[model samples]
Target: MSESKQDIMRFPPSKITDVAKALSGDLRVRILEALGDTQLSVTQLAEALGVAQPTVSINIQILEQAGLVVTAQGSNREKLCSVSCRSILLELPSRPGDGLHKTEEIRMPIGMYSLCSVQPPCGMANRDGLIIGSTDDPRAFYMPERTDAALLWFSGAGYVEYRFPNPMPPGVSIDELRLRAELCSEAPSFRMDYPSDITVFVNDLPIGTWTSPGDFGDRKGKLTPDRWTSGTEYGVLTEWSVRADGSYVNGARAAATTLERLSLKYNQPIRLRFEIREDADNRRGINLFGSAFGDHPQDIVLSFIRFKEHQEGKES
Candidate 1:
């Protein structure tokens, strides 16, 4: 990779087969995890794990070949290593009617995520604190395992905001917005209104509404819970939209953000908000699950993957 692209793009996948193979071993997983928080020498890792330097070297070689780790010249010409890519972004081959991998253009990362609570009854959550109960029950708990959390519940309605990184770099401006979440009413036993009507706001401007249908676990989720709740209910609903001016769920126009709806000054912060008000007789309240770049909600992953890929293509 060119030095400029490397500066812009943090991690690039080495090769699919090599990464798959290296991750197949337990020792290699440990080595990768050890390197996740800090860069360490082979000698340091060997001593930490009570393993031999040769063993550490062999596993690290596998990691580097797989694109999971990057070895480089450290301070004063010492060999240094650190994680290259933050996470793996999959590249799936196209099939009939498959539009997942295709994109007219890529978007850039703008800001990080932030949260704001409107009232006492409402709450906020993210990957860090998946289940943020009401302020009365401010203690956060883990949602159940992906399988067990068919639905997750919390009281009230407030905005979970995502703040994009500052200094929006040059790129094709973003025109589409997407959302993904796990959905089930209150319990695994109860079915939710498929494609429930919901409103999306960008920068406090009403963009549009979408009726997100139930996603029956055909794909792995980007933000799966680290642990499951001991005895609660949850489900999954991953949703996305393309209409720039208004909300769209299953092709019907509602409300959402438009290109004109946003103020895109360079280095300005961007905010995306998901607001869903439950109708009367709705049983489980709000159970939301999706991606949050840091601690807030927005179309972060899609934009981030595009930025990473764009930087990679520039390098190539």
Candidate 2:
């Protein structure tokens, strides 16, 4: 039994009431615990819990509406239910007098790239697994509907660029910058040994490169839309961070580019680009995943950790 890729789901503070309501029932809690590892049909779940099938079905429907579980038709034609996330996190808005070390977070959809230059075997799909346009057509990359893309893949070398708004206030200096996304190597069908050198750039300057282990398709992605029944399922979540000292991928130092080199300032747009250079040692290609199609329920997240003069002595 494989659990969902992301064990946690985060919600804003405003949704606490709704989330609380979803978990208020004892049956719902038991259903979640039962579905923690393996998906089960309503009848099976009812039998295991010693409850009537109709009673379980009713609760399952409520859980589905609350986004706590997702259901699909099993091979036997029965509805199969699985837990959506293992935990929940509530994000509370910061107060004005909290502190001087303010952090700004932005999430960009995978398809919202301002610029893209992709080769053949490239394509985009929404959460419903519908192709945005013809596959391998560069023109499709410019489609206005791309903003809803949940996954994008390309073979060989190519790049996608995004312009992020700088959220630092005047006179404030950025102490750290972090970018996170779920990605993996791409192959026509799928390969476990395929490797790809995925690189990231800030302000057109190379930040670092991460070597994806392979194009994985061993099993269905926990969050993958039900319509997608084939091809690669999910990707590993990767995080790249940069500070005055150095840059790192998943906390391991990978580059020496400092925050000063990025020159992040107020009113200036930050350019972030992802690419698989033609000259890369491994040109196997790459896949980018969004919240709807990845193990991680997040898009391209960019975080700016800023430090004010008065907060210089404080730890973030």
What is the per-residue lDDT of model 2 for residues 1-316, given as tens digits with 9 covering 90 to 100? 2555367777764455556777899988998888877889999899888999999999998888767788999898999999877777876634321323256689999999999889888889998998898888978899998998999999899899999987665555677899999999999878888999999999988888999999988888888988885588899999899998989999999998999888876788899999999899999888999999969899999997756433433458
User: Considering summed lDDT, which 10 consecutive residues are worst modelled in model 2?
Assistant: 93-102
lDDT of each: 0.47, 0.85
Please provide the root mean square deviation of candidate 1 (C-alpha atoms, Å).
13.4
**lDDT (tens digit, per residue) of candidate 1 on 1-316:** 3232233222222244456788899988887777765778777778777889888888888888766778877666645667665556544422221222223223322212255333333233445444344433333222123222222234344434555542334443444554444442222323334334445566677655544443223322344443533222234433445444555544566554545456655467656665555452322234454443211233224332122233312334
Alpha-carbon RMSD of each model: 13.4, 10.7
TM-score of each: 0.42, 0.67
Highest TM-score against the true fold, candidate: 2
Off by over 4 Å in 1: 1-113, 118-135, 138-153, 170-172, 183-197, 211-232, 242-256, 277-284, 290-316
CA lDDT for candidate 1: 0.47
Clashing pairs in 2: none
